[model samples]
Target: MRIRFDNTWIADSEQAILLHEPGHYPVAYLPIEHVEEGVLLPTDRITTHRDLGATRWFTVAGPGRRGERAAWTHTDLPEHASVLAGHVAFAWRAMDGFYEEDERILGHAADNYHRVDIRSSSRHLVVRAAGTTIADTTSPVVLYESGFAPHWYVPRTDVDETALTATQTSTFCPCKGIAGYYSVAGIPDAAWFYRDAFPEAARIDDLVSFEPDKIDVFLDGKQLGVEPGQTVIAHGLDRGLQPDEIAHRDDSGLHNTEGQQ
Candidate 1:
């Protein structure tokens, strides 16, 4: 993995270690040797993780760039956590972490839990909001994700596209590329779908699924409430660059919004 911020390559390593914290996606850890010199400035801020001992933060800076509290390292670790010693990891959303010249992922780092197995289903699914049927699909794809409830993805044909107003809200799932949202009536971002799903999740391409918590989802004749692991959480650009920290450059010349070449 390679990390870049403000147009400078700060770190690159073949020894990138992927750490998957429960309830979150995986994060890459690179050996201190792989990081460029004079980039990580120790900060007073310190935090701790459950397994990784006392952690310290750093304001990472590189050629024309500065990310405040953007990097962290586990300073005092238990002996078993020796592998994490002298290694630092950056937040995926805080900085641009790429796998190669064009392989970059956003939101959270990819994890094994990212994979979703899809199977076709004949059971009828109806999505209702504001007393109107937004979708009535007899042909739905059953998506089984590791920690999420089994989702019913209704084909566009069975959905009342007119009732779905596209919203600015979008999220990136490592295995699912970018997901878009749609609003129903007054409900904001009540539905989400993978307009262009990654190859691993191609089965759900263009199929919209309603958030059980945001709207009423019915299977056959029973209502479905929020599932145990269904989260409507949104990912933010957690860290921001300081103005005058770097000159404005044309991002189009080097990277696309999707990082897909």
Candidate 2:
């Protein structure tokens, strides 16, 4: 389900309202400040759930105060008879446990995924290296899928390593929480993460290696190929499931169900 905040703490240049969730019913959770005065007609359906979940609904309208009737216009919430309003507080007084910091105010924790898509029609590169492919577009553009001098992630069994001269360089990603590096002879500038193996990126554990670059890239050729300046769609893989629940493979050879792979 989708949830949005009306009076977000974002900078003025940014939208004070944020659009969250694209699945299920979109729930609108506006900050108290975002609700215009007189428009909020509070409700009293306060009930506690066995799981400790609680919520309240409010009726909202506009023709607001002081010549301002559309305080919520900036947000995507539709104008209706009223709006829901209530603050949820949780206290796990069951066991000998209690949340002193009130994690409830943090709203629902979002399930984040690292999904990316690579595509380019200029040289049909994206389509060429669609299977078992990985590319990195960190800062300066480097094509890891292709055996280039700049050394990046390439298929473990694909790349021609005669040009590889492993260096001591390494880096990290806050998202996947993985770190590694690489280099080539006399070039001392190539880097590789893992080929079909990652202790951290179990989601993309099959990715051999990829070059991090400013612009996206694509690779094509031999065991390792080069199709620079292309985009690759990446995502996490799910764990165990029954045969009937298994996902189908796509033209890219990546198994995906719904919009996720």
Candidate 3:
């Protein structure tokens, strides 16, 4: 997925760019910018590949060099068999083995409830499914701000952990962070996390778990409340609500919710 060029960047750019390295298995390069400008010297050379043909090459200039020397051919290319390792640069990869249309239709009518909450204490907005509660040093345990949907962080000691057990699955979120998993035996995706957390989100360090969107999210046998519509960034320092480009809808089109039925 990703590879680092110990030290190199494209000519004069300040950002350390990661370009898609094409091949059998695509790899990327992250050269130090300063090094590229001062030391990368082009050579009058070109190589061909059996699968993709006409690969280019370059050389680094020595300290006292006027030009360049020493070429290391680019190896490790992508091929049909190479897909197994997936993308190294990608933190996680979906292995559904189907195109967008096929994958989307696989679970088209799946029922799930998505909930988002902004903490009053931290003001950090967390997207989570309704009904799940996190535990920690608080009365009602908090939830972790992890998963595909955001959920606010709640302390762990405040939750009832009797209904959960650790699971083998794991996931990474660039926004929130990596998560450890827990699940209810008969339920799918009722995974809860603990142990690791997003750095600034200390509030949920050891106190969160999620109820499957398909299940009723509850607290100590009590049902957690749900909203009839999508949550909007009503009031905050960020000012206007998010989804800036889209209009708001009432309870129906946004996400589903659960209550004591």
In candidate 3, how many Å is residue 4 off?
3.2
> In candidate 1, what residue range of length 10 has the lowest lDDT sum?
240-249
**Residue 65 miss distance in model 2 (angstroms):** 48
* Residue 230 error, candidate 3, Å: 12
In candidate 2, what are the lDDT values of residues 150-191, reduced to their tens digit?
A: 333334444445545566654433223334444533333434
By lDDT, who's the top model here?
Answer: 1
Ranking by lDDT: 1, 3, 2
Candidate 3 lDDT by residue in tens digits, 34-60: 233534445666666455344444554
Candidate 3's C-alpha runs over 4 A off are 1-3, 6-154, 218-261
Worst 10 residues of 2 by lDDT: 90-99
Ranking of predictions according to TM-score = 1, 3, 2
Q: How far is candidate 1 from the true structure (C-alpha RMSD, Å)?
A: 5.2
**Better-scoring candidate (lDDT), 1 or 3:** 1
Per-candidate TM equals 0.78, 0.26, 0.36
Query: C-alpha displacement of 66 in model 2, angstroms?
Result: 45
Error of 1 at 107 (Å): 2.2
